[model samples]
Target: MSDRNDIDPFYDDRSDPVRVLVVDEAERGERLATGLEAETDRIAADTVPTVDAALEAVDRRPIECLVSTVHGPDGTGDELLAAIRDRYPAIPVVLVVPDEERAREAIDSGASDVVVAESVSERCFVLANRITTAADRYRADRRADRQRRRFREVTDAVPDCLWIVDPEWSELSFVSGYERIWDRTAAELTGTPEDFLNAVHPDDRERVRAAMDRLSDGTSVDLEYRIRRDDDLAWVRTRGEPIVDDGSVVRLVVLTRDVTDRKERERTLSALHSAAREIGSADEPAAVYETLIRTADRVLEFDYVAVDIKRDGYLVQEASTLDLKDGGYYERTSLENDDTFAVRSYKRQETILVDDLREFDVTPADPDYRSALTVPIGEFGTFQTGASEVGAFDRDDREFAELLVGHARVKLAQLQDKRVLRERTEQLERQNDRLDEFVRVVSHDLRNPVNVAKGHLSIAREQYDDDSLEATMEALERIETLIEDLLTLAREGEEIDDLEPVDLATLVPECWRYIDTKDAALEVETDRTIAADRNRLRQLLENLIGNAIEHGGSDVTITVGDLPEENGFYVADDGTGFANGEREKVFDPGYSTGVDGTGLGLDIVRRIADAHGWDVRATESDAGGARFEIVGVE
Candidate 1:
């Protein structure tokens, strides 16, 4: 026999032919090889004389099958069969014997076939058929074995966990890459269907079971669900096909993939997009809060949402998705500790998470509420979310929640800045209109006084009279007053940049000296200190006092008193009060009831109050006098 072991057994075409070992007497083996050529054109035979030569031939070449006589020169055919079966089971053996007893013995010894050969020529055809059949089968078996090994090699390199199971799912037939990917051996996971299903996450097992139940023969199933490993949770995408036999389901081949990373990334992206759409388009803080809570419930599925803002040193519930009647307030100082999650989050300027609310220092309003996450919105407030299940929030949930809070904070900041810009723009527009009016009034008022003075001077120069000269001097004084008022009005349009604590008692008395109070009685009911521009506030007081003395009589009692709730201060008089309809109009530029008074005094008071970010409004005093209250003094 020729040594052909270096040759590949699985040739692509018939040119390479199947290799066969013929073990018998030299003449018989030569006849058998010739007959095999006649029987099949794709087989090549090599003759060996004994079991020893046959074994050596098999090791030296890719022998597909063996044909030998029951009696050979070196050994019996049964012994040759034993040697081939022991060392090369994949090589099928065909035995030829001289009688029925030998054929029976050869058949009993596990030969592929036993042929009784009364004459060598007659048995040639039978021997040829047996060798060809055995060789073909051996070739096919080798091809299949190679394919299975190739498949295993490829599957072991991939992340997908491939498995094959019996129809009833009682046992796993095969598994690939389980040990590498799942950090568990295949033996550990191979078991009944219930054993495998038990490894699925409790919350997701029922759905997986339902999907499995719906599967039928010839059907393929695909699904995604969470599963519990030994120590952690993982997301898996499973795909399976049923192996059908005789039109019935026999087995299931499933492929499961660890898709935790992919699922997490997808969830994060979906949550961010949802939050962006919800908070980005909101027009106001209320709308933003509403969208934030609704999106939080939808995205994170939290049980409740609440936002608390610091107002006047008190933590007031700005917005809440919780149904509570008294969403009133909490003392800001009292909750500024670790006792409250919201307070701790706000003071520390960090996010706080509690997996079990019962373990927290503070008492939960809802005993069923188990977990909570609180994040600070800078110095603005605290945003809180609650969950009804223990361990509901994980690090991923915390990260996503913090991202949502960050988006909310940015959106809210934009909204607030937009509102402030709109308010300042409107204020600038109003000031522009007032300045236009001031310019027109100055033009009209100054022209008349100047024209009168010029005409009176001409008359005085021509006639040399005391009355004309006096009239010119009075007209000049009026022009001086108008110019001074215009200068003050121009200066009041600017915002107050510097502020210091001012005592109302001292400032009010000082302003009284600057204004012509006449015999007007001054009453300082309260002595409070407020942050204000000292010079601008003094001008405001002077104008209010002047208006009271001018509109009322010279003896009008001007009373400066504190407003209710410590909100601000009020200036009033015990003179003839304003008519109900005229109170609001009295603050308009160029509006005065008195004949000798310029209408700009009360308007200047309003402008000055606006510059200091104070709210000034006209109302009735206790003495039934005109009252101007300036609130928002802080």
Candidate 2:
């Protein structure tokens, strides 16, 4: 015998060698030894003279293939083959039998191959090749089984669906974990590659098909589309990667995920932003409702929207998505009518969300509309939307509706307030016009009679008591002064609409020329040009200058200058200033410190400043006299 270390030159060490068990009597074993040893390059042989030895040899170490004689010392070869099949079913068996009858029996007994005794001498190489090939095939199958088990474990743990298709797309090559996601078995979806495309929504079918057409190269595929299985619909993101081998496309593997929640949220946010921008810029309440209708129809997918304003214990329709021909039908129908749902929401001061409009007592404007959402705008009204599909209004829709309604309520209130202010301003202007006319008439009608009385008393002074005539003339002079002050007050009360750039330096001197300064000196300090109503500003300056001259001595210096930081202008006099606790009351009409003074002058100054949107303040001047500062000049 050769040493165990001697390797045959014909053996391919890279291939797995078969370990074979030869079970027979000693004579037969020795007879077959020569043929088995000839192929020792690929087969390792162990001789056993009996079935018991064969069983012991198999248990001691794994046997890849078995070669047995028809009859062994302890049992028949078929018996030994049966024993190994029961215990190590994966091991292949080859029978070396004496005759054709036993060969048939061995063939029926599940042997891997059968060799007749006569043909064994000439077919030794072929027999050994079969044994080696069987062993290689078994090992490959075992490795594939292990890999499949590991793949199943990994795919079962994730939420994604994994599948593979051949490059030709004739059929699916591999599919895993799809049963859990789509509630379908692998066998059900494996034959047709079009099964995947068929499951996609009709709108996305062409996109998916186009993506598949681009899968010829070893490129990746990513797509988002909608899918439907029976009545269930969802947004799915599918990504595919090609399996390449030697720069050739082998197959495409794909993963699909459900992204419905993410897509819905994104759409809702976009709708809300669009609605807010459109509604906020609308100028009137009607325009706001119109914008809401268009935005909700385009983005929120609402088929109808209505705006109702509460008036006289009834909700009146102000705006709607519906276009009425006569327009009186909508306006004539109030929320108190039996078929309106807005009244319910308004009465409860809460939102009403109905999946099916049939549940409500009232009939919807459109019979196709099933989903309804109504939000109350405090006591003002209700804004409602209706959709054609049942359960279309989800929690996201409800939240968006509430936000839009809240913003619309604020804009409507602002519009109403603006309208009220405009009407009130017009009414006050009419009243002022009437008052101005009355003052002009009184000044014209009463001033001439008093002047005539003064003249008549003067003429009578020579013919009557001098004391009585002097008293009569003094009364007439007081009446003339009162009439002039009243006329000035009434005229100044009118609005100042047109303003021009008036230089204070030029205006103050002009006003000084009109005032009786007596002996007061005028000091001009400012040259700033301010935007003002020229005539109204002249009146303001005249009043301040006259007030200063009346209180200050004839030699008192009246200073006119700009305030610091362009706040406005200041008029101050170098005279004995106001006493304590008199500044706040200085502008009151008919409140005068001098017995001969008319107190309407300072009040008219305040009115003119207010008309120009300026603020006036009374304070002490630098020369210990009164100061009037007009701030907020433009």
Candidate topping TM-score: 2
Shift of residue 594 alpha carbon in model 1, Å: 42
Quote model 2's TM-score: 0.61
Task: Work out the TM-score per prediction.
Answer: 0.50, 0.61
lDDT of each: 0.79, 0.79
TM-score attained by model 1: 0.50
User: Candidate 2, residues 1-634: lDDT per residue as tens digits?
Assistant: 1112122323333365567777777767655655776866777777788777887888877677778767434545778789988877767888877778888988887887777765566667766777777777765555565567667767878888988888877778667778765667777664655877777889999999888777746778899999886698888888989889999998898898878878877886777777777778878777788776666666676677778888887777777777666331245345655456677888789999989988867777567778888899876888888878889888877887888788778887888888999999999889878886788677877887888888888889878877877877877888888888888888787778899999999988899888888889999999989999998899889888888888887788999998868579899998999988899899998888987888888999998998888999999998789999999998
Which runs in model 2 stand beyond 4 Å of their true positions? Answer: 1-160, 176-183, 200-211, 216-227, 232-248, 255-374, 382-394, 439-480, 490-510, 519-535, 552-557, 574-576, 622-624, 632-634
Candidate 1: list runs displaced more than 4 Å: 1-17, 24-28, 38-42, 49-53, 76-79, 154-158, 164-167, 171-174, 177-191, 216-220, 243-247, 274-441, 457-634
> What lDDT score is found at residue 100 in candidate 2?
88
Residue 242, candidate 1: Cα error in Å is 4.0
lDDT of 2 at 390: 88
lDDT of 1 at 536: 88
